[model samples]
Target: MSAMVDTPAAQPLPRRTEGSSARIGALAPLSSPGWVEAGRHLLAGLESGVLDVNDAGGVLGRPLELVVRDTAADPQRAAAAVEELAGLGVAAVAGEYHSVVARAAAAKADALGLPFLCSSAVLDALTDRPTDWVARLAPAQSHGWRIYAEFLLGAGHRRIAVAAQPSVYWESGTRILREHLAPRCGTVIELDMGALTPEDVCDALADHGATALLLLTGIPEPAVSLVRSVRADRRLAGVLVGAPAGQPEFGPWAALLGEDGAGIPFLRYLPERLGPLGARVGSALRERLGRAPSFVAFEGYDTITVLADVLSAGELSRERIPASWAGVAVEGTRGPIRFSRVPGVGVRQWAWAPVQVVDRDPAALDRFRVLRTG
Candidate 1:
């Protein structure tokens, strides 16, 4: 049975009766067209967090419940989930891995006055305007991708090529790379995945003298195919393949590509050393996952931790949840969790989670090597 089967496709999202369990809505992509591996890790962390909270006597003397809804990587579906969850009387909403989907949920949550602590989405513009309704645990795309750009530059990759598909998230990432790199004498080359085949990408890389090729496309399809093509081509042997979206952080990427997936630096939000709390959580997550947990899992765990703290701080009412964003000071798995207004960001943002550019070590394919940190 797949992970999707373990978690039902849809669960009833009806309002909880008064004096019953306090509910929080969870959004994740747990089925096809979504990153199932990521969703499973995220949900595992969330469920674990809930279990720990309940073990500690629950939130505000009531069992804290998660009303999970599969976003399935759909923006429209995510928006509707936010509306339904709001009507279901969930105190707030949490968890979404995709940025575009989270953006939709954030907009809807803001409109409906629901506090949403976005777990994994890193899009800088999470909302249309500055609002107090949403906060994010992941570092913004600009911040993390800039670190990636610096990593590329430090490694002597000035001429970079990105094989990208059309996405608000991917497009935003491309633009950020362009703006950040142009002044620094780094040129970004765009190879549209829609127009180019894997073979054509290799040919273009050689023709353009591009030293690095970034996979801004989706997983397992063009991304896997492109890496294979680039790796096998003798003409482009020196060309480095990269996936800056952290696609390589999950198990499937390594399982599918084997050693071919190694050396593909991507962004991950984890500290160099897991502190005591993070180490414990990481161990628990690894046991629960039956494998190493991705950073998304930690994000999910921290989301519930922050929410539990806010709900326990005093006012447990829905209206006061957004007001609690500023005063949060919980120790998260990544580090201290706090929210503040970041310029150019419309949501109260955890200014950053630890950003690292890491790759699967080529010699020891199971281990990740930290290439750079920011």
Candidate 2:
């Protein structure tokens, strides 16, 4: 896909028929370079959301339809998808797990005056300036990472090392961890994964006397290697390994690493317990996904739930949807869904979705144990 072109004027809503569907543009990273497992779970939730909505009579008695696009984790592809979706007269846009890609999509959607409810992107600034055109369901990186930092402190890790790849998203996360930990007498050691090997990272942890090493690198390559190297190092045997970016939330991380993957903490947006609505949604999502649903999947379901509420509130015009964000109050699978302006975030945020520090249990690699919550 190409880069986003000049902003187009807001297109009129498509003509409705009694049998015609209400279209929503769905974006996901379904190919390489993107987290394909995360995308599959996200799409399952999105598709499941549409199914539930249609079963409930959909928006204004029209079936809710998803115009799915594979972003492949490219910002250019995502931006272009937004333009195409806007031109297609989609009532709104939703779903993107990658923060950078979501930023591109959000910017394009904002420019095109297309209302977008972001599903799982947690970057603090989804847009450069505040815009009613975009809103997000996931807690901001600052919010969630701060919680993870707290978890680290409570776990007695005052010195931490981050093996990070270069990216705006990773940089922001590192910054969040550093800033949050600094005032509390904690130190953050930066290991540039671009210049260092996984063995080098393990050596750094031993030399720096850091008690925790967070994986801020991409999955299956540096991240997987770093985990293996650190776990194998006798000098760093007691060191805590974490991935605050939620890499361990999906199946592939466990599938590849097996017992080696267990006990590595990560951030997840979910409550301690699910309500009746959540239980039903979880069961349906499990059936659709052929496995347990990650928090990203629930984020997808909630994205459509919020959008459906906005569309059903009154008029289904594109212009009307942005305004409806403030008025939104619906029961999402996670919890009560509402949007409000959060400090440092440009888009209307869910205030917070439930945040947890979780890791797969060593005794049972398939099960997750909640280590902390915020």
Candidate 3:
């Protein structure tokens, strides 16, 4: 006898409790290899400050609770995570480190009409997409590329060799650098990161007589390898090696390279020169994690703090958050945090995010001196 097939009923979406707590969703790569600690630091920042709303008198008289979800740095998983967050009835969503995952989650959040404030995803296109519900705390790669190009040119490096990994973030940054440097520099050689080994890259620099080498990659392994190779080769001694501000694994980079990482500069959002607020945040982070906070950690802390301020001033709802955010100007760990619609990047995005150049010298490695700000 043929049996009738059983159909499972769809699960109901989570309803807002309408009580003393307001829930927010955080989507990040908590299980991934490189970004797991970043996720933890983000959570720690929230719980220690904004999420402890009850002690701080709460936002709109409601304490904040963060609902954490791991995206595993996967695009599909990121999209699903957004849906799950919406189903759980969060006031809004935030936190993502990977550019691909952030892009996916941004689209999902926009379609679902949820507010998403991206923390550390620096891919230029993350804010370039046509989405009104999404905003970024980190400056786009285009802005960062401009800063890097200017820094190189100002340092009298005319012959520049670019080595970039094959990824969305690196590719976009490489393109921007080429555009900005072509007219200004005497010679700019573009090298595909995957096609060449560390030795091959150094050899190309030696062959071209490049004065400076710009290594653009998100992963620490390739950057560490390239820096090591360059230092070992005596011929390429004077070439100034630099990296962009996307690598969150800087602690590992410092540990692996030791003194070799010295004189190698990279862009960063959080300069060591902190104001009163920045100093307080840094101390709190050190206490919680047993070390100073990374740029990603600061981004997470600021994102929640911004959201809390917005929620406190106006009605607590996803629809109202964007409008509220656009009007307020708050002091972040970096500096004044504000949002505006740039010509290229999307609306309500924080375009004027500050950046600095930090070197990895053994004696002064921790000193994140400000090279340039834009």
Highest TM-score scorer: 2
Q: How well is each residue in 1-374 modelled by candidate 1, as lDDT tens digits?
A: 01101111222235545668888999999987998899999999999899889999888788889999999999999999998888887888999999999999988887777789999999998887787778889999999999999999999999999999999999999999999899989999999999999999999999999999999998888899999999999999899899999999998998999999999999999999999999999999999999999999999999999999988873567766667888999999989999888888878889889999999998987799999999
lDDT of 2 at 293: 91
TM-score of each: 0.95, 0.97, 0.89
Model 1 gets an lDDT of 0.89
Residue 332 miss distance in model 2 (angstroms): 0.6
List the candidate 1 regions with Cα displacement exceeding 4 Å: 1-19
Q: Residue pairs in steric clash, candidate 2?
A: none
- Poorest 10 consecutive residues by lDDT, candidate 1: 1-10
Which residue pairs come into collision in candidate 3?
A: none
How far does residue 142 in candidate 1 sit from its true spot (Å)?
Answer: 0.6
1-374 per-residue lDDT for model 3 (tens digits): 11112212222335545675777898778785536776777666666666445677777777888888888788898899888888887888888888878988987777777788888887767733455577788887788778878888888888888887777777777778778888984467888877899999988999999999887764466777888899999999899988775452346666777777777767777654688888888888889878777777788888888888777765676666756766768888888898877656663667666777656545766544555665
